[model samples]
Every structure is written in C-alpha cells, then in structure tokens.
Target: GEEVAQTPKHLVRGEGQKAKLYCAPIKGHSYVFWYQQVLKNEFKFLISFQNENVFDETGMPKERFSAKCLPNSPCSLEIQATKLEDSAVYFCASSQSGNTEAFFGQGTRLTVV
Candidate 1:
C-alpha cells in the first residue's frame, strides 16, 4: 500500500480494559512511528521501529504501553489497563528512512471511560 493503513478508526474502552491498535505501514517503507495526539496541536512520539527492529521508544510509557513491528505483519500498539489519560488520537506514520518525510494514516481515536 502507498499510504499507511490504520484499523478501527475509533475505539471505546473502559478504564482498566485493554486497547490495541494496528498499523500497516506503506510498502517498502523501513521506518514506522507511533504518536499520540492528546491536544489538538500536540503530537507526542511514543515509539518507532526500523523495519522489524525497535528504533526508539523513549517516549513510550514503560509500564502500560507496548508496541511491535514484525515481519509480514501490521505493526501494533497495545495499552494494558487503559486509563482516562490514554484517550487520544493515535497516529501511525511511515517513511523510507528516519530522515525522510513520513506519511501518516487517518489515525485511531481511543476513548477511555
């Protein structure tokens, strides 16, 4: 695919439940990034992968958030014990390399209640 494809445009989760999101990066792109948009203009980088390897995950919450990019599979971000603060629009982006411009998906909006 030429564009990043994200599944389940919207998700509603109860507090303490689990929420998982999927992202299929553009074919041939080697880098995939996951970001959370809490505020309308703020995008916080959570994790990034170079191919199937973890690149950087400094911004990801160590306890409740986990992500993976695997061979021949759509990348995923999973949140365990969902919290109200976890409600946000998650954007998946992909690029040929770290330095290239990224192409983003429409995003998955997660709402925790």
Candidate 2:
C-alpha cells in the first residue's frame, strides 16, 4: 500500500488486560517507528526498527511493552499488562531511510480503565 495502515482504530482494555496494535508500513520503506502520544502535542518515541532489526528502543518501557518488525508481516506493539497511564494513542511511522521524512498511520487509541 502507498500509505501506512494501522489496525483497530480504538482499543479498550482493563487494567490488567493486554493491548496489541499493528501497523503496516508503506511498501519499500526500510525504517519503522512506534510512538506513544499521551498529550495532544506530545509524542514519545517507543521503538524503531530497520528492516526487521531493532534500530532504537531507548524510549520503550523496560517492562510490559514489547514490539516487533518482521519480513512479510506488519510491525506490532504489545503491552503485556495495561496500566491507567498506558491510555494513549499509538502511532506507527515509516521512512525510506533514517534520514528521510516519515509517513504516519492513522493511529490506534488505547484506553485503559
């Protein structure tokens, strides 16, 4: 596809439930990133991959948060145990290269209660 696609526009999870989001990057893109947007104007980088390999994960949570990018499959971000603070929008972005401008998906909104 020419645009990045994200699945399940909205997700509601209990405090201890698991939440998983998927993103299909534009064909031919080599870099993918997952970001969490808590506030309307604030975005926190969660992780990034370069052709199915971890490129950077410095902003990923040490626990409960995990992600993956694999060949022939869409990238994913999973939360093992949802927390109240985990309520936010998860956006997936992809770029042709690390220095190129990224294209973002519509985003998945997760609400934990």
Candidate 3:
C-alpha cells in the first residue's frame, strides 16, 4: 500500500479568488484521483489521471475546476474562482493498476470567506 501526499493542510481565500490543492501520488501507482467533500455523506469526484495523462474526468466541473497530474511534478487541482459554496475538504487519492485499493491523503480544507 502506498500513501498519497497533500500539501497546505489549510487554505483561505476570498470570494472570486483562486484556490489550488496539490497531491503526490504513491510511487509505482499509476492512477491518481481527486475528490471534493462538502459533507460527510457527499464526495464529488473531480478528476483522475493515469501517469500524467487524464483517464476519466466525467465528474469534473467544466467551468471552474481543473486538474493535472504531470510527471515530475505534484498533481494539482485548482479552482479558478472561489465561492462560498466551494468551501470544503479536498482529498487526493492514488492506487496501483488492477485489484488495488485507492489510498487517500489528509484533505486540504479550503475556506472561502
């Protein structure tokens, strides 16, 4: 099992500002994912990448959210425009190909005020 690393445990931004979250996928794992948790029961899958190439992004917001998992760099999830509704815990996850469970990092809590 490998661990996903995330930076900046907390982020604060004003309305209309930008918020960026970073993730480091586990070594040897090819799939990396991002999710937004606004409530305990709700998790919105944001995007996924297979070794720097996007695999599935059906859940990503078309207008405001963007993500990348480029090689030799930390995977990043960014919100171009901050909103009060965007305040939430953003989680990063990673897994190896096939039959492997995904591992999540400590979420980055974003606050928009």
Candidate with best lDDT: 1
Report, for every candidate in turn, its global Cα lDDT versus the true structure.
0.96, 0.95, 0.89
Error of 1 at 7 (Å): 0.8
Worst 10 residues of 3 by lDDT: 93-102
Q: What does candidate 2's lDDT look like per residue over 41-95, in tens digits?
A: 5999999999999999999996999999989998999999899999999999999
Model 2 TM-score? Answer: 0.97
The digit string of per-residue lDDT tens for model 1 on 44-97 reads: 999999999999999999899999998999999999999999999999999998
lDDT of 2: 0.95
Better of 1 and 3 by lDDT: 1
- The worst-scoring run of ten residues by lDDT in candidate 1 lies at 35-44
Residue 91 error for model 1, in Å? 0.2
Instruction: Flag regions of model 2 displaced more than 4 Å.
Output: none
Candidate 3: tens digits of C-alpha lDDT, residues 1-113: 25788988999999999999999988989999898899664999988888989988999887999999888899999999899999999999998992489899998999999
Q: Candidate 1 has what TM-score?
A: 0.98
Error of 2 at 82 (Å): 0.5
